[model samples]
Target chain A: MALLHRRLERSYSARSQGPLAAHARTLAVDAAERLGRLQPGNDFSAPLMVAVAVDLAQANAGATARELLERTLRLEPDCEPALLALGFSLERAAEHQQAAATYGRLVELRPDHHEGRLRLALNLIRTGRRPEGEAGLRGLLGAGTPTWVATLAAQELVRLLIAEERLEDAGEAARAALLRTPGDQRQWILLASILHSQGRRPEVLEALRALPAASRGVAPRARYSEWPDLGAAASQSRLGELARGAESRLAAALVEIGR
Target chain B: MTVARCVPLLALALAAAAPAAGADIWVTITAPREGEYAIGEVEIAAEVVARAEVAEVEFALDGRVVGTLVQPPYRLRVDLGGQSIAHRLAVTARDAEGGQATAEVSTLPPPIAADFEVELRQLYVSVSRDGERVLDLNGADFTITDEGVEQPLVTFARGDIPFTAVLLIDASGSMFGDKIRAATAGAATFIAGMKALDQAQVLVFSDQLLVRTPITDAKEILAAGLGGTEARGGTALTDSLFVALQLLEERQGRRVVILLSDGIDTHSVVDMEQASALARTSSALVYWIRFARDADNPFDDGGVTMTSAWRSSQEYGRQIELLTRAVRESGGEIIPIRRADEIAPVFLRILDELRSQYVLGYYPDDRRGDGRWHRVRVKVDAPGAEARAPRGYVDD
Candidate 1:
């Protein structure tokens, strides 16, 4: 029993010591026993049980995981770890609205938590609150925010702008991304495509010329399709067809320029 | 071991104690994740962690024993018909040696699916006299006819009643710059003007449909939703209209769709006919707010002088005729604005009209679900009063 408890405590934050089925069950039973003996109002019991639930849940025992988390929440509704795990579980189960609400609660409980806000924003966008989602993403990119979050925000912002057909803004965003990561073929292709969409043939040629010789051949296909918010009905058939036509358009333009 | 490590190990040994006599079993209710579920048969499954051989598992709801399984795969299904509210679900696992473990989960009722029966068909009727709403009227002062047959009014309510509205805004490329800003402001003004109980959703459509906000009464959230929308991509006017109607169909009370667009249909999977059919069938009223760049009086001849073939063939003529037909049939109106700033005023006027209107609902005497279009007519009894209502509905 002492060895099992020691293993559980040591494996709590270790990536290599992923919870095995037998070990997770043992840990869960041990945690449940400890929770049963602890004073009803003790603060440590809830987190201890939540950790055991997370471990069991990671071991393919989601039902056990959920039950444990729910039990902890019943005692301490503001338990951050339990709420975060439950929200993640609900999200994986495709219960987006419920998951979004859970994450929203997490945001309220821990207003300064970056991951909570990021997850809430994602769930909001997934459930069709585009404005709030976009605003939250932008908020996460503001000054003093984490660099990782800012990088992700920049990608999502550019994707959203391109989706809205704001090519001028998209071009600017793509150029900005290029400045951040110079010689990136992806940004060059995006800049060229945005110029093409705007019917600026000369600028498109200039963008193409700027790309490294090895990177220049086929124009980076503009994927203005795949609107996830629109659900499964948003097919990429039209965009795919347009991309195929673009390949030929680029070929012809290259011949005309004698490149 | 060092003294520090030895002290921690001693504390760990004190914390780990084996239970006396019978082994402790950890019981967990797994299925039916802690959330809401509508009234239906629910299957409850449980997991029992035990060192000893498990004997039986009992499933109960609200303290009543639902079922018990002696073998593995302990699961039970309970009909949750009468349980419309929150209830506690519990599962108890008992070993052969008499040791027992229990787990309980509480659940609330989920949102009812959209297919629920439409009990009352609420209509938002705007009665006007020379471009002004005549708000003072009783239930008996109005008459409703479905397919030319008079419908007995079961219920009647006047304005300030809760209404569910979908603000279908066009963020297409053509509606760039000032147009998008105007539409956003117009939508925000409309949302602000809604009654306390009123709810509105913002749906921005270009080639893609982006739901800015689901049904909500919070002005800040709705404003943020609208403000974040950027105008780009081709217009999918018909597709958006269809989606708006579909969304409003599931809502209760007075249902309305405030469609703000430039009256152009492009890049839509559905056509105007399908969209028109949907609007004709749905009880929700649709108001079209079209933006015109110039003073175009081509359809000023009351649509009588224009031939049917001409109306169908000419692009501008066809769009005008479609809008007129849609508005007239839905018992709504088409408000055309020449300037972006005028949109806020137009929205305010529409909001006023919404507040002054009456809702009338009646069950049809005819119950043949033959799926056919039924033309409707609404008349006002008071002097100098005119009633605007949906032109027809499909019996399905």
Candidate 2:
């Protein structure tokens, strides 16, 4: 019975360690164990236990995932995924600085990993490190990352530019993304937005009018009935005497636009 | 003496007879019509009391001398034509003693007509994003599906397309600390992503909607209001969103909304359902960002209760999910970012999505105003490629 129970427990633990659940559980257990071990001054087993915790956490466990992640750092202090995961977890924990340091370590360990770089940039952005974040995204884009990575990088760059009120630069980035991928609806919208912001009415109109036939059909139509029409005497009549003369004419024009 | 006194008294009594009074002269001049006469010829009529004689009468237009008349209740006609616009006419009548009175009238035309129209073209959009999606769609990977259909492709060209975007920032008190900072940073990033031709309006809301600034450069606007913001009220996401939609409806070109919030609506007058409906009916697209905080904070002194914060955060997440669904239904996308810094990248991704859409145009076969809503559907002729369009257009 004891052996059966032990086997059942092992099986349960193993099942829990499956790819989907392992990371979270591992993190939780690792955190719990590391704290326990650290308090007792058990430094020797800390690294190994923490490493195991990281592995479990990466496999997608629960509280254990975070616990293991912290334990791994307490033990080895430089496991890349542990650091990265810790940083991400820290960010999740709202410990932006700590997360940033973890992300920085991950970047240092694997400079070529675009995901790592991206994560680092994101952390930097959270910490108000605009320049670093911008540079990281730009570098990733220039490095010919995957379409998704590049897209994200480009987006980040463009967003930063826009935040800085560098519309021209933002426009350039948008154009670059468009050039790379012509079917992106968001890019087109952003481009159109930049043009509109600059008071380029004709160009803006042209852009809107030029929406792909597929998307154009979805564009909402003006509700003429709900809108006031000064051009229509009956409709204008509802406005009373105030709808007469120059004031009426102006009101009518407004109605036309509203429509 | 007595006899003299009696005679005097009798004389006085006889002299107690009688007495009387007399009269004066007054004259008045009147014209047949109530208007100003010219300088050449004129007509003057007079009315006299007690047989008084009329000495003279004079007329003028705008204080300029016209003519003089001398007659007693007599008619004299004067004509001076060729006047520009209108003038004020005055007449004076004088008696022998020079006692005179005056009267005047004014002549003018009616008001003129003016012909004028107001042109408002703002932009609005719907947005969505997923953290797990590996395909970083450049401007090319997106297919806009409107109203459960596909549309043709047109205006597929690239560059800085002009538009006006509204940045709706959630300023609820619950989004304190890093959440607020992240939101601010994200807002700044969105602003920085715009082109010079594009304008953005920033609206920050909690229980009430506060328009921080009208459409302007994203960076400057963000910088001005990002600081000194304390997220301490209920979320009025729906109201702010509605305002954005209205603004976009009035603007020309591509319209969009970049909603930066935790997606919790503690104080929204309009619920998510209504907001979704409004989004569907609007031409604008919405990009919702749901910022999630870490759940491991042991110290419970962060103003908001942990359970409430978590609940609110989860609610925000749910709202974001709903918003994402709304964007998808309206041919837009919702982006979720775990970190505050991811805000900028998310915005950029939205932009990329905007550019990559397939624009298709076609003249519909039906042109009748039968007051019916027409459904539009587009499909890719290419193998393995899908297409989408808006649901329908109302013909009234």
Candidate 3:
């Protein structure tokens, strides 16, 4: 095995030896320190040090882990793993402000890094800076944002609006998600449910009708909003027919949730 | 090995020899990673090192026995199901000397399977007239209908039935300060009321399960577990409820889930519908002790009422609707109190009601496990005799 990787494995093995392993923490700390002192000539030194830091954090030596993370960051300021590990350790300790600052640094370093920005926005919300966090979420839902990140941002923004009693805005946000990510079907369920809650029957029917049709002859269960089959339920002939002819708009919207 | 190593080894030996004190068994779970969404056949592996000769390790799903391991690598693989739902795994280890120790871990609750059980259903019914409980009713005195079809009772028991309960206290960030203290006191009151034969587990959850004691009749142990908890997360009410049902699903006899919360769920992946389905599946009565957010306008509290619906998040309306409906369908009641002080009294009152309730079980005539909601109605024949039972059940 490679020398650094072998040391890493041995360090972990020492920690998990048993309850009687009194030197487990000390051994782990020593291993991390030794790895940190490794010459910078080895290309894997930085990443390996970051891994040892994460292992230290998991072993409950978080303070020592932070020290190692700092050393890694000093050597490689743009180290993504080191930043994320440090931020996550802080977040786990409920130090949301510190975590947010760490994430902010990562975001500044890599503006287009979707995960970094997402973590930053989440930490901002956790630190009680709701308005800025809400704005951050909104900014991520633009044209270039990945589908996963946009979906998450949309969910968070709508949740915030809903918490603040801005139901109409939440509905709009859900609709915005549908628009931003074209051909995305999941948002349609979210949009229909939001509209159904607001009693927007026409729009509810329109959203449900817009759902993708691919299935054959599946029936609609009475309760659709209860989280029906995921994906497009429009293929269910009964659902489409119900959406068109059902007297109750809420009933019609629920019918297509068979997806 | 140095003397430093020998000291820890000696301590482990001592800890292992301490049998009756329950200090010998040390269990640390290594699998079913907490934050990861686990589905299909998830492995439940734990590193258990005991002082005594390790006899066997038993793993349970909810309270149901899943599997037992007699050797090293104390692990068992469990099928959580096709859909991701909140699953609580209880692992109990028994040494050769008869010493036993147990620990519990819960999977991150996910959106559940939309189905119900077709087995024998137990309904915990409480009858009252003029705000007084009429506890002397028999099986002959009551008539039950499933989907409007009259069904014969398979098992009927009145009072004296020992019940297992899970007291769910919401220790969210909003529940900080006096709210948490009141909740703790209330939980203590419920634990104090449990009979020596009755078993209960206290689950204090915010975004995570902060305190979870095993099902025990020891009041001091239950009360001690209630202390030192800091309220600091969003309320995961639905997920917590689903966890409660999972914890109670395997326990025999009558089961009760008493929830104390001041707000709608803000951090749960498991929605109310899935929780509702699980409630019906388990047949455990769910009592929600809601502390009113607004004293003056009760309807404006928790965004549950129709008047309050337009104000809060759209999802809250459905959550409150489904949550309240699910509680009622489990034949349990919701008590809303404006003051934090009313918490203990409400908890005591629910405990009293549980002691006086009647349990009826029946095999549904509709044998087909058609995943449809059934309308169930229970009636009493005597004059002014009001019977409170589940409104219906979902026959999955």
How do the residues B167-238 of candidate 3 rate in per-residue lDDT, one tens digit apiece? 899987778888889999999988887865578988887754567787888888889879986777556677
Q: Where does model 2 exceed 4 Å of error?
A: A1-259, B1-156, B217-219, B293-322, B355-358, B364-396
Please, what are the lDDT tens digits per residue for candidate 3 over residues A197-229?
A: 565757765764565421122111101111112
Model 2 interface CAPRI class: incorrect
Per residue, candidate 2 scores C-alpha lDDT tens digits across A1-259 of 1122222334566776444343443443444354545565443233334434444444444256567566556655655545655665555445556767877887787888676687678668767998988888889776468665675566567767766789899889988977785654434545665665566756654554443311221111111001111123432243233224435576678899999
Model 2 DockQ, alpha carbons vs. true complex: 0.01
- Superior candidate under DockQ, 1 versus 2: 2
DockQ for all candidate structures vs. native: 0.01, 0.01, 0.01
RMSD of each: 34.9, 34.2, 28.7
lDDT of 2 by residue, B1-396 (tens): 012233333434322211112223322344433444222122434333322344666666568754566754433332222222345556665556545555455544212232211111111221223322222222244443434544332213222345577878887767877777777776676667665446788777765554356566556765676666666555657656755675576654456788887655544323455456557656566667756544453212233322221123344556555666666655454565676667777777776665544333222333354645555444333334443334444333
Sorted on lDDT, best first, the list reads: 3, 1, 2
Model 1, span B115-182: residue lDDT tens: 43323334567898887889889989988887789987755667555567889999877788998898
- Which parts of model 1 have CA positions greater than 4 angstroms off? A1-259, B1-122, B293-320
